[model samples]
Target: MNLYRIAKWVVSIIFYPLFRIHVIGKANVPKSGPVIICSNHISNFDPPVVGITSPRSIYFMAKGELFENPLLGKLLTSIQAFPVKRGMRDRNALRKGLQILKAGHTLGLFPEGTRSKTGELRKPLAGAGFFALRSNAAIVPCAIIGSYKPFRRLKVVYGEPIPMETIRESKTSPQDTANIIMEEIQKLLDLHK
Candidate 1:
């Protein structure tokens, strides 16, 4: 198996039991075609949790700091994770994200740029909306419900795609589309919590 599959298998073996992870609405993810999976960030475990539960491999932009450690960086890269400088506009990272989407791959994004210390939904950054509008890809709002505490039931709920037409008709800017995405995420949170 490839690195992504191997890593996913290992993570599943370790995390499924430790966290009691539960995945719901995975069928909401498009089996093929370009797609963006936008989720609320809670803990460091969020990305891998989403990755393993997802029906397809997801390319993620991890914080640049994580890549400072060469070994971890190599491992992350091997599994399709790239580093992105947070708190600023990183053109290269943005370009990479668009390229992934234009190439019809699934890209995972934490709309809330950073993990929420309080586990509450935060305002989404503009990148997710930018990818959605620019690539016209399907946007799947996901929610990671429950804390990462051991033996606790953690849920990864995938919601229905937000139609491009709806976004285009109502959202004129990246932030506007981002707001809509957050709303969908919030709904999933509310429903699942």
Candidate 2:
């Protein structure tokens, strides 16, 4: 098995037992084709939670800092994570994201850009929507609740795929699309509560 699969199995085994993980709307994730998984950033645990919960392998645009450590960076890269410099245009990273989507892979993105220390959702950065619109990939808004604490029951809710056609027809700007994605995530949060 590949590193991604190995990591997924190991993480699934370790994490699920540590915390009660409840995954909802698994059917909402497309079985094939490119997809954008836009999730709320709660904690570092959020990535593994979402990654293992999904049925398919998901690639992530992780912060550049994580790639600074030689060994850890290699491990992360083996699991399909690329680095992105936060708080800048980071054109190279964006191009790599677009390439991933165009190649029909699921690209995971924390639209909020950084972890929310308070566990509350924040405004999304434009990159998520820009990639979604540019790559014409379906957007899946995922809300992860209560995973910030160890041994707490964690809930991951995946909302229905927002079609690329809908986004295109809306004629909204990239920033607006990002806002809409965040809004869907907020709705999922409300529903779960």
**Model 1 CA deviation exceeding 4 Å by range:** 169-171
Each prediction's TM-score versus the true structure:
0.96, 0.96
Q: Where does candidate 2 clash, by residue pair? A: none
lDDT per residue (tens digit) for residues 9-75 in model 2: 9999989878888899999999999999999998888888899998778999888999999999999
Model 2 CA lDDT for position 134: 88
**Which candidate number maximizes lDDT?**
1
Stretches off by above 4 angstroms in model 2 are none
Candidate 2's TM-score reads 0.96
Worst 10 residues of 1 by lDDT: 163-172
Q: Report how far off residue 12 is in candidate 2 (Å).
A: 0.6
Q: Show the colliding residue pairs in model 1.
A: none
Tens-place lDDT per residue, model 1, 85-185, is 99999999999999998899999999999899998999889988888888868899999999889999999999999878966877579998899899999
